[model samples]
Target: MDLTYSAQDDAFRGEVRDWLEDSLSGDFAGLRGRGGPGREHEAYEERLAWDRHLAASGWTCLGWPPEHGGRGLGLLQQVIFHEEYAKADAPARVNHLGEELLGPTLIAFGTQEQRDRFLPRIVAVEELWCQGYSEPGAGSDLASVSTRARLEDDTWVIDGQKVWTSLAHLSDWCFVLARTEPGSTRHAGLSYLLVPMDQDGVEVRPIEQLTGTSEFNEVFFDGARTEASLVVGEPGDGWKVAMATLGFERGVSTIGQQIGFARELDAVVELARRNGAIEDPAIQDRVTRAHMGLEVMRLNALRTLAGSGTGSQGPEASIAKLLWGSWHRGLGELAMEVAGGPSLTAQGPPYDLDPFQRLFLFSRADTLYGGSNEIQRTIISERVLGLPREQKA
Candidate 1:
């Protein structure tokens, strides 16, 4: 995989850096580092405004085609934008679920009518989305979903529960996976449906986490109705479309994620030195190993993107998932170890946690969400290595 940046690409990077600096340094300065995992409630309204500002400045969807309201940039240019954005410490985006996942899926797989109906809203951040693949019974094994939907008159009626749905409470719509055929088992007869979230039939209850935040949620769809035409692909082709969306979930932004990881690692290293934890050889060894892991994560992501197409990150994307998820969790542990005894206590009463404490707590789920480490290993073994599938009970 080539890592060289051309003169034009370097100029593009400069433009992105300058715009982010100017934007974040001015009226939006308060949002420089607000709003992320474990802290999604921090200045949320302002962060939403920051997202709109990004959309207006034409900086939100860099790699999508110009016809679809994106810059149509090359892969490396996209990488440069992400690196610069992370370096600038911009606020976490509010519509990433729409911009990164659904936008690309519609562009690649949706009908022209579907693209016309959804792409504009996604581009302008007028709507936010959440994935409904994981049901109460099916979290990592997504194909085992039991949510049911059926066509009635002119609408599709849905009924089921989706747990661990991030941003559901704030989302305007949800893309759901449901059993469209009666008594359908496992993967067959499932449909990818775009269901609106504001109807009386829908309910969203927040799930509080160890970090004392409720960014994740449980959504109940009791006869939730969406337009019959809202199905993404063919009725039974949901698995293909869903898998592609998951691929996009592990897209080029992972490079920026690693950048954030590096920053956090640097902070932990400083904490160790200040607290004298670095005087101990074991703490020193863990910190050094974290630095090395970050480098390897970056190289592996670049290699994976080299073989991937525009929207699909490919089956080997599991390897990237396994790598970063475990590495970030490990970094959290190292942070706690560096902090020594104080990491065990909260900064304030009622579960008020300092950033380091929050990191240690929230990173606990990094390996479990999106796809669990065990599930990722299974995908790598069966899909990438062509190993025989494990026998199920």
Candidate 2:
């Protein structure tokens, strides 16, 4: 595959970069400068405003059809746009679940009414969305999800729980997967539904992480009701729909995140230099390794996109996830080592202090989220390598 961009692609990149620079003005600057994980409510609102601004400019959904408020750009242009957006230090948009996952899935499988109802709200950041896939018992083994949504008259009555739901507390809706058939086998009995969070019988409780923040939540559905029209695709075809969302989540979402990771890597290098650790041979080696790891990830992502076209993720998506988890873990460790005792204490200036300390703690979850590294290995071995399936418990 040719790594070099065509002349037209290069021009498109310049246009995107210029647009980002102009769009990220006063408040955007302040929000982007806030380096740590936590952001104030005002900051989040400002970020949403920026998202809306991008949507209005037709840059938000770069790869979507023109009718859907996008530029109808290709996959490479979309990737370039993300890369430039990160470089501009723009505030990260909070509508990722909607823009990155749900919107695309809806386009592929949802009815025209469903698309018209959700896609516009998603683009405007007027509605926030969360994924309801993982449960108390079912996580990496997603087919084992037992959240039941039984048809009751014209509505589906949902009852079960979803754990580790990111931003669910602040979300307006949840794209959920639940078992619609009692006797049918796993993976064949499920259905996907989009349920409003404000409705009766729906409860959301925040899950406080070690970082002292409630970014994720445990959601309960106690006979919650959703119209049958909210269902995506036919009943018993949910596994396929869920996989499509997961593939987009694991593949394209990683592209955006890796751009952020590249920025973080640069911050690490700068931190090392300021701490007088740049001269250390070991530190230099770690920095080089981190850069190399990110390059490999970039190439892998490009290869996957080029080979599949239309950003359809394949088994290699799992490999990218695995590499990302490992690379992030190593980078975090190296950052902590370079920072020494001061890294543990979080009292200094946010930018001057060790950013990696928080990153290191967060990296612990990287290997586990969106299916664990062990599960990725299983996918590679069984699906990619054509190995025999392992015995189940």
Candidate of highest TM-score: 1
Give the TM-score (vs. native) of candidate 1.
Answer: 0.99
Alpha carbon deviation, residue 325, candidate 2 (Å): 1.2
Give the TM-scores of the predictions, in the order they appear.
0.99, 0.94
Q: Give a tens-digit lDDT track for model 2, residues 1-393.
A: 777899999998889888777766665667664422433233666676777777777666667787876667888888887777777777767888898889889988999999899888887778999999999889888888989999988999999999999889889999999999998767999999999999889999997665556677899999999998999999989999998887777644467678888888888888888989998998999899889999899888888888878776877788888998888878778878887788778755543223576677767787888889999999999988999998898
- Candidate 2: minimum summed lDDT over ten consecutive residues — where? 33-42
In candidate 1, stretches whose alpha carbon ends up further than 4 angstroms from where it belongs are none
lDDT of 1 by residue, 1-393 (tens): 778888999999999999998899767999987888899999988888888988898988888999988989878888899899899989988898998899999888899999999898888889999989897779999989999999998999999999999999999999998999998788888999999999999999999999989999999999999999999999988998899899898998888888888888989999988989999999888888888989999998988887774635988999999999999999899989889899988877878898888888999999999989999999999999999998999
Which 10 residues in a row give candidate 1 its minimum summed lDDT?
A: 303-312
Stretches > 4 Å off in candidate 2? 33-42, 348-354
> CA shift at 143, candidate 1, in angstroms?
0.9
